[model samples]
Target: MKTETIGTATFETWTVAETADAFARDEIVLIDVRTPQEYMFEHIEGALLMPLSFFKAGKLPGQSDKRIVFHCGSGVRSERVCRAAIEAGITQIAHMEGGFAAWKAAQQPYIGTNMATGAPQRAPA
Candidate 1:
């Protein structure tokens, strides 16, 4: 997909490794745009929980200038979230190419508390 910028926010897309690199350098804020229940299942390490519905409800709680990389279960919802962020005037935005499933397929690490059992699980890299 073509990456476009809106005002001060630039939509720069990236692959899993590229996203991970940005996270490693502390240059991007990863936001999990999935539902709270899905987020509780598992998510990329260091990603913040910000449901897409929350943004749709006009409850964005972060700086617009922050570099945001959004992800969902398999990238569908996250893509919608990125578009919404752009519509909401967030210029610097991106979506994980393949979402959490892709991250897991790539053997990337993740952490989360089990929703059903409340047990914390850390995926092994």
Candidate 2:
């Protein structure tokens, strides 16, 4: 985890491994801030979809009770989401460092498209 502060807000960047472990232990609220189409194609299991196109910082779930960790396709949009949260008074924010790409590169299990049937399948492969 790496922490960065800007203005009066501070945010943390978590590696894919760290995010996965915390998510498995139910220690964080993992949010997928990518497009709905992207999420439908493949995403981490149990990740909440709050597409950046329609993200409302004020609507963050468990903002005060749980650690909200945001992730996007490649970390760009998620970082933007983090800024939005800070602007909305959400101080304790975190985002996956390399996003979904890194997660897959790390070979973490996720809901992936089964090309054979074009259906979502658990991909530990």
Candidate 3:
């Protein structure tokens, strides 16, 4: 991961390809900071939910050593979340560049449907 300094805030960033590769290898954990509804609309498979609206300034779920890669609609919110995590003393933190938009643009495999329904449905055959 590469480092960049923006005044008092500094965090690492990963491109879509890098993120996908890391995810494929189980090298990093993806955290989606978008709203639950937005997440339900479409999101990367296996990502943990930590919506910014209900975010707490502390360690997230899972082990401390795992790398956490935060992402949102357009990378803005996730950056804020990452900074907050940093302030909260989380060292292994990163954010996806261009956020979920880039991932969608890249046509990466994701899970979700635009239609909102509570009924249980069969998985794709």
Best by lDDT: 2
- Model 3 segments more than 4 A misplaced: 5-10, 61-65, 114-125
Ranking by TM-score: 2, 3, 1
Q: Write the per-residue lDDT of candidate 2 for residues 1-125, one digit (tens) a residue.
A: 89999787789999999999999999899999998999999999999999999999998765666799999999999999999999999878999999999999999999999999998899886
Tell me how far the alpha carbon of residue 67 in candidate 1 is from the true structure, in angstroms, after superposition.
Answer: 1.3
Question: 29-95, model 1: which lDDT tens digit per residue?
Answer: 8889889888877777789988877766255556554567888888888888877777777655688
Which runs of model 2 end up more than 4 angstroms from their true locations? none
lDDT, candidate 3, 4-118, per-residue tens: 7655546898899999998999988899999998887778888988999998857586446567889999999998998887788665568999998899889888875634565
lDDT winner between candidates 1 and 2: 2
Compute each candidate's TM-score over C-alphas.
0.79, 0.95, 0.81
* lDDT measured at residue 89 in model 1 versus the true structure, 0 to 100: 73
Put the candidates in lDDT order, highest first: 2, 3, 1
Q: Cα miss at 8, model 2 (Å)? A: 2.6
